[model samples]
Target: MKLLRVGPPGAERPVVLDGTRYLDISGVVSDIGEEFWRTDGVERVQAALAAGTLPEVDVTGLRIGPPIARPGVVLCIGMNYATHAAETGAEPPEHPVMFYKAPNTVVGPNDDVLLPRGSAKADWEVELAVVIGRRARYLESPADALSYIGGYCISNDVSERAFQLETSGGQWSKGKSCETFNPLGPWLVTADEIPDPQALGLRSSVNGEARQDSSTADMVFSVAHLIWQLSQVTVLEPGDVVNTGTPEGVAVSGRFPYLRPGDVMELQIEGLSTQRQRLQSAEQEA
Candidate 1:
């Protein structure tokens, strides 16, 4: 099932995508959020669809919000793709390199991506985001990790090179947690629909020109392994999001010019969905 949320920013209601039409599931469940996942929301929605009781919602001009509600935590893995690591002059790590992006940074897929004032090195990173459905702790193996996932979706891990590399003194969250830095979802394809998470193709383009075009197959750490590895140290709770790193071809590599106001980014992961966001300057902070 492809789950989604549609409406104004704070008014989004849950729905399920059936081909081109969207069926209102708000009557069956609240927003696709932590509580929804904890109560077997997917199974309830599936049952509603099977019983043919859901009504079609006309979302002709409403905004499409992120599929899941605000996550408790937005975790990110960096340099998981060997080629991406090589492009940035780093060697592949022995284990997943993890970081965090503020949960507030998440915006709707088609929303404008805001660039901080005077920013000169903003960049785009197309990644496959994993959404957690169940609590994941130490009692696990890589083989059991798949059961903890709820869905998969597209994520553009937008970054600011200067803040991330130059002024960060080594921490990555500053550049990564900027407002609207994470544009997620057009739809969250349920786990059952994706039997093999490692086989999807991920690609991104800037202003219609190709940037990162790669596949999950190139990732040094597979989805299940990353989850299992992370569980050993931290608990992955329901509705937490994990961005499984981006592929090669970002401005940080010096091959492409860094993003500026007005530049647009388009990203896609096969079978999950696509996201398109335009870069814009943010108003000065109060």
Candidate 2:
């Protein structure tokens, strides 16, 4: 099932798409909060839809927000794709490279991406994001890690090369935490819908020109391994999002030019969904 949130920004209600129509699940599960997905809410909604108990909602009248509310953490993996690493002139690390992005940076699909002040080399990276369904710690194995996931979504990991690399201070968080850098969702596709997460084809384009285009098959670290590794140190709570990492074709990979004001970005992954974001001027952000 394709689950989503629809309405104004802060007032979005839970909804499920069934073919061409939408069923209102807000009456049963309110917003896409932590409790909603953690407490078997997906199963409940599936039962309701099967029993014809949910009310039909006209999705055409409302705006769509990110499928889930503010997650507790927005974890990210860097250079998980070999081709992407090669393009950047970096060797693939033996272990997963981790980072964090504040939840405040989360925004809806089709929202305007802001070009932060003094950001000249802002770039785009399309990645597949995982949403955790259950609390986990010290996961025993890769298989155990897969059991903790709720579903998946499309995420644009917008970056600023100058802040991420040229700056002397810290990790990539500076270039990554800019507001509106993470545009997630058109829908949160349940895990059952995705037979093989590793087999999905992912792609991204800037202003109709293709930028990042590759398959999850190229990921240096698999999804299950990432979850297992992360759970060893930090607790993975319900609704915590993990951006698995981007594939080849990012601007910083040197295959293409970087993003600028007025450029639009569109990204998609099989079974997850697609998203479009328009780049706006820094003056507009001010």
Candidate 3:
């Protein structure tokens, strides 16, 4: 089942998409949060849909919000793709390069990406995001890690290079945590539907020009490996999101130009779905 959150920003209601129509799950389930996915929420919704118990909703009239709400952590893997690492002139690390983005950065799929004040190197990175379903600790192997996954979604890893590298003594989080840095959703596709996350193709374009383009197959650290590695250090809880890193063709990769006001970003991954967002000046925030 493909789950989503629709309506205004703070008042989004749970919804499940069945073909071109939507079913309002708000009456059956509250919100698309940790509690929902941790339990048998997906199964329950599927059963309801199968039993013809879900009410048909008018998704066309509602605004969309990030499919998941209040994620415990926004964990990200840096340079997970070999080509992405090569494009940035970095060597592939033996272990995953991990970082954190505050949950406050999370926003809906179609929301505008703010070009933070004093920011000149605002960039775009299209990535595949993983939503954790169950608690996991010290995962024994890659196979063990796969069992913890709940679903997948499309994510835009908006970045500011100057703050990330030069201003913060090379800490990536400095450029990564700005408000509205993470744009997720449109839908949360169940794991069973995805079959193989690594085989999907992903691409991003800015103002109609292509920037990031690659497949999850190019990842240096596969999804299963990253999960296994992370579980060894920290417990993976329900509703935690993991951004598996972007591919080559990012603005910082030196092959393309950086983003500016009025620039639009469109991204898509197989099975997960597509998302589009326009860029606005930071002045809006002031």
Q: Under the 3 Å rule for N, CA and C atoms, how many clashes does model 2 have?
A: 0
By TM-score, the better pick of 1 and 2 is 1
TM-score of 1: 0.98
- lDDT (tens digit, per residue) of candidate 1 on 1-286: 9999999999999999988879999999988989989999999999999999999999999899999999999999999999999999999999899999999999999999989976889999999999999999994589999999999999989999899989998899988999999999999999999999999999999999999888999999999999999999899999999999999999999999999888989998999878999888896332
Local accuracy of candidate 2 as per-residue lDDT tens digits, 179-219: 98999998998888876789999999988988777899999
Query: Model 3 Cα displacement at 266 (Å)?
Result: 0.6
Quote the lDDT for 27 in model 3. 76
For candidate 3, give the lDDT of residue 61.
60
Per-candidate count of clashing residue pairs (backbone under 3 Å): 0, 0, 0
Candidate 1 vs candidate 3, TM-score winner: 1
Using lDDT, rank the candidates from best to worst: 1, 3, 2
C-alpha lDDT score of every prediction, in listed order? 0.93, 0.89, 0.89
Estimate candidate 3's alpha-carbon lDDT, on a 0 to 1 scale. Answer: 0.89
RMSD, each candidate, Å? 1.2, 1.1, 1.0
| Cα-based lDDT at residue 239, candidate 1 | 94
Backbone clashes counted, model 1: 0
Instruction: Put down candidate 3 lDDT per residue, 78-170, tens digits, no spaces.
Output: 989888888889998888999999899999999998998888999898999999989989988999888789999999989999999889786
Error of 1 at 128 (Å): 0.4
